[model samples]
Target chain A: DQQVKQNSPSLSVQEGRISILNCDYTNSMFDYFLWYKKYPAEGPTFLISISSIKDKNEDGRFTVFLNKSAKHLSLHIVPSQPGDSAVYFCAASPSTLYNTDKLIFGTGTRLQVFP
Target chain B: DVKVTQSSRYLVKRTGEKVFLECVQDMDHENMFWYRQDPGLGLRLIYFSYDVKMKEKGDIPEGYSVSREKKERFSLILESASTNQTSMYLCASVRPDATGNYGYTFGSGTRLTVV
Candidate 1:
């Protein structure tokens, strides 16, 4: 069974608009969540992350919100730019002490920021 | 900065051929991982090594094997290549943290096509 899920396969947004990508996970044991952005022919690069102890985390134009009660999380990119167009993947993992930092990832959502 | 290097950017192999994908890291991290990214399936782990001569299976281990004879290198071996095994292979090195700062640096994936 898939522990993490991204229901949306693709999303298109005009430049400078707010782009929100959502993810859901089934395992309540997951305490750490991460977002990674991947371009074609390249490996993924870390974007942002949130811990279960907090409901939200932000970095400049990117913010991640976690709803622990709903087993859901969302990544919001404010003023999304063309350069932000890529496949975004949400990943979840339990404490490293338990799983040795093995990350379980969602299928991924392709975000397209067009002018 | 830590960097992970994949030996090949692309490879095409015929069915029933033995394949090897190499990964090397330029950091001191002792943990290395191999993952395959497929369309609509995100990234799935195949194998991981915590230290030299120590390895662990990940979510998908069938038809794939790994070797970690040195600290800076990890090798993924396909005993006999199959078309089903064709996918973009990525290698990563992990840095564990307690406060949700788990850093995973990935290489520029190698795309393998088996006919």
Candidate 2:
């Protein structure tokens, strides 16, 4: 079974609009959430992250919102540009003394920004 | 900037042959990981190491083995290549953190094709 899930396979948004990508997790112990952006043939690059203590974290045009109660998280990209088109992956990790520090990743959502 | 480098961008190997994929990180991080990416399945961890000569199995470690004799180098070995093993392999490195909120730096990835 998948511990982390990205329900949307693809998303499209107009340039200069807002793009929202959603993710969910079944593991309640996951306390740290992260988003990574990937291009074709390239490895994933870390974008942003949020801890369970905070409900939201923002960096420039990218914002990540975490809802621990719902086991859901969303990434919001404002003023979406064509350069932002890529696959977005959501990952989570548990915080514990014995934790291995391995991250569980979602299936990923492909976002396309149209001009 | 942190940099993780994979030895090969693409590799084609015959079935039943022994294959090796090498990765190196310049950041000197304590944690290194090997993962495979497949369509629909996303990224699945094969193995990871937190210290030299210490390794732990990840979610998918059936046909793969790893070596971390040194801090900066990690190697993934396939005892016998199989067609099903064809996928994009990624390497990542990160610093150990108790909060579990640290982001990982990933290499460009290696595309392996077993025929």
Candidate 3:
């Protein structure tokens, strides 16, 4: 079963506009969430993260919002730039007894920012 | 900065052949992971190692195995190559933190093809 799901396969937005990508999860054991941005032929880099304790976390132009009750989270980029176009993946880590800290990932959403 | 390096950017192997994908992390992080990325399947964990000489199967470890003889290196091995196994393989390393991010420090990825 897919514990994490990104319903939108892709998103297109104009430069200098807000781009929002949504993700949902079916596992309640997940306590932490993260977003990663990946470009073609490149590894994914960490964008931002939110703990279950907080509803939101912001890092400059990138912000992540979490809603624990709904098992949903979103990444918002303000004034999206052409350079920001890439595949965005949302991952969740659940607290486990083995301390593995394994992450469950979503299918991903490709964000295209046009100038 | 942590550097996770995959030995090959791309590889092609014949069916019934054995394949190995290597991943090395410079930071000596205890946690290492192997994930396969598909068009609509996102990233699925194949295996992960928490320390030297230790490994565990993840969600999709059916046709794959892994090795972690050293803390800095983790390798994914395909016992028998099949067309179904052709996909992008990614390796990641993570330093355990209180914030819980298992998706940190990923390598560029290895695109493997089986014919």
Most TM-score-accurate candidate: 1
Candidate 3 Cα outliers beyond 4 Å, as residue runs = A96-99, B99-102
Deviation of model 3 at B94, angstroms: 1.0
Interface RMSD for all numbered candidates: 2.6, 2.7, 3.3
Over 4 Å off, model 2: A96-100, B98-100
> Against the unseen true structure, what C-alpha lDDT does each candidate score?
0.92, 0.93, 0.91
Task: Kindly list the per-residue Cα lDDT of model 2 for residues B1-115, writing each as its tens digit.
Answer: 9999999999999999999999999987989999999988889999999989999999999999999999999999999999999999999998875655557899999999999
True contacts kept of 1: 0.52
Q: Largest lDDT belongs to which candidate?
A: 2
Q: Candidate 2, fnat value?
A: 0.47
**What is the Cα-based lDDT of residue B87 in candidate 3?**
96
- Superior candidate under TM-score, 1 versus 3: 1
Error of 2 at B106 (Å): 0.4
Question: How well docked is model 1, in DockQ terms?
Answer: 0.57
The candidates score, on chain A by TM-score, as follows 0.96, 0.95, 0.95
- The digit string of per-residue lDDT tens for model 2 on A1-115 reads 9999999999999999999999999999898889999999999999998888899999999999998889999999998999999999999988533335788999999999999
Q: Write the per-residue lDDT of candidate 3 for residues B1-115, one digit (tens) a residue.
A: 8999999999999999999999999997889999999988999999998899999999999989999888999999999999999999999998776544545699999999999
For residues A6-33, what per-residue lDDT tens digits would candidate 3 score against the true structure?
9999999999999999999998889888
